[model samples]
Target: MPSVMEMKPLATFFVSHGSPRTLVDETPTTEFYKKIGEYARREGIQGIVWMAAHWETPYDTIEVSSNPNPDKDFVAFVPDEILDWYRSYKINSSPALADRCCGMLKDAGFNASLNSTAIWHQDVMIPLRWMYPDSSTCPPMSLISVNGRFDPYFHLKVGQTLRSLRKEKILLIGTGGGIHNLYTLSWHHIIYYKDTTPRTKPIENFAAAFRESMNESVVRNEGGPGLGRAMCRLLKHPHFLKCNPTPEHFLPMVYAAGGCTSYEDEGSVNAFGGENWEMNTQLNSNFVFGLPKDDTIFLGEGS
Candidate 1:
């Protein structure tokens, strides 16, 4: 007899919610998100289970935001325009859905909770709003807070814990930068990241190299057993540090990566933005683990 899990149909995704300006700027990454939105529309994704680099809890357990109104998180008000822009958008949440997710995780033996204290960071807002545009059409959403260790395996397990929901048409998205080297951020012109018309900034060579290597491992690697092997190889690879100065941002990918059963196909990766001091190398590359229904091209939702 097949267990309930074997009957589910679901796919997981990893999306990069780079700088706050991602929505306002014209970039390939944002365009890529629109593509994802189109895919979601056709697939009829019921809701989203997503996490942002901004939220982290010291506790070892996982948390689901049960609040329908997540706080407009982020305190940097230096650029009044940025703050105002972030607050202008009225973002809503789904307490019922969030509680459901927390229940699922807890059932899986994961330390999970339904949190009323959850705040919606722009990391969740920007990309989602850009993709769905119309808030009403956007699926019921819940936010996950990262644990203290930022353990890749733990996050992966956290994602795996929710695998059952995939069949229910819920979309699992992990939002964060592909490479987060905060020490090198161009804080001087932080507000005008997109103003660089011609030349973009430079990121460490090793950063880009590591990201490429990871892409190859996750996307091109073959065999079910090969997945673990590839991860081992990449983690020990020389580019690890250059790719992630601190592991929090990269942890989201680990969560997203865990969604695949094995040999999941990766969609087109759109690497963009080099304006920050981290330069061209601090690219926010994104990946999708499951194949789209029919792999149809073009934009917008279906009839």
Candidate 2:
């Protein structure tokens, strides 16, 4: 592992893992994931602290994984071959860092605890696999869960609590969809299959609107308190319920936004991906916050 001083500073990221299919598909979102991996390797990121939409603790309590070697747990319907491919590699973790995260949350007046038996769900693994194909070279990860209550403000506060981790050369990531309405997505898939069978669903007006609103919110706002305030407003967006029937998936974005804040208030935000919408309802939007404005490594031609 490289020392912290030898590595370039990292920004907090919110990446859309789409589905387990991302592992095999060569879509724009997956390509963005590959770029993130390339950047991490080039910058020598020391570790990763992740928050995912899939794992949520009950009530106001937040759980952190202290397991040195966690097991696999996937939510999407991945085929046997894909599952086999995923299991072929070993992902590592850091119990010491996990404990430290729990401490930070508890000090902030939140009920937080450690679970040594925590499992690595697809939400946590899929992006990691894509970002670091070689598990052995992957940074040591520490998984944290969002509150089941799904209060956007609460998760934002949690991210703010851990923002200091960025100075440690740790990359904080939130993995969830920009627009995730499974019901609408299922119907769209059925409709498309009857026509010319396409891999992705047709983009809906409401979905596109929601995606644009989200992108604007991230790009227009600065990191930290202002960004957190902007993210909280997303809950009140006209298409919020339509795009996100539940708060679990969308809350991770708020969490990631909170950690993007910096002490000097100079953190920059870049909408690194989201050129394609998946399942019609999901805009695979991803963002990186706290990078310098002149840093062009993660920015694309128009970004």
Candidate 3:
């Protein structure tokens, strides 16, 4: 019989890390991150490979966090107890995982490089560090946005390369929001003060549309045309310019999902409880390209 990690199918996820405010809010988004970390601990994952929007590369290079002492300042505001819990856990940042992904891509006739100079200490990872402080030490891999252009075929190719790493029991995580138009949304004002203005309606609509599209992608088991169409519609949405001024942040999730063979719900949590309220949600969205019964990892009960 295969080992537990080997037995479990490879998983992929596209999580909404919300804005930086999530680190300090008593809202749903913060709760969502907490729930996700708890679920991961329960799932018995050896380690997670994060593909975060915060760690963008300038070209086609893949940047791997090879820092001997990865930055921990991202979670400076986290409670001591939470910080201790993470410090006590034995988490490994799998730099080797990054190498594996790069190798796979190179063997498949794709030009890929491993970059270690990139900094990922921004919106997404900062909040993630707070939520999963114990796992913060885990190795992360990043793909740079090619001058703001999104090539679906190239992304799919990267996903295909990532498929090989899943067999080794790495949980691949793609972090970013479905709608990430920071400048236009005025992320600071809305997530903090609870703005109910009608202007924000477009943001809500975009979020709802994103959720629907994700659910559809999971249920349908294929994202090629359907997913692309939904994304295109989002880009054309009137408020698109405000919510996602650029596609770089939004595209990472797509690449993460495209790499998976199958997806499973680990858990879902809601952070706030008001109309037009900010929703910082987390889901143990698991993915496996196409591994047989060789995949079955459970991470605690679903919320």
Best by lDDT: 2
TM-score, cand. 1 vs. native: 0.82
TM-score of each: 0.82, 0.89, 0.64
Worst 10 residues of 2 by lDDT: 188-197
The most accurate candidate by TM-score is 2
C-alpha lDDT of all candidate models, in order: 0.65, 0.77, 0.48
**CA deviation > 4 Å runs, candidate 1:** 1-8, 75-85, 148-150, 191-203, 222-225, 228-233, 262-281, 292-294, 297-303
lDDT per residue (tens digit) for residues 1-303 in model 3: 776455544555556555443444554445555554554555555556666666555555554564433443244434566556534543344456557666776787766666654444444454465555645444344333322454545654565556545555556656666555444454445445543222433435555665555444444444334433443344465644545677666555556655552232222211111122342222212222222222223222332
**Across residues 1-303, which tens digit of lDDT does each residue of candidate 1 receive?**
556455445456666776655656656667667867876787778888896777887757778888877678764523566456566666668888788888888888888888897778877777875687766677788888877364577777776677667777888888877776666655444455444223345445676678668777766643233543565456566978666767777777767666654443233221122212223445576766544444453312430
Tens-digit lDDT track for model 2 on 70-157? 8887544555776776887687799988989999999999989999998888877778767887788888889999774857878988
Could you give the candidate ranking by TM-score, starting with the highest? 2, 1, 3
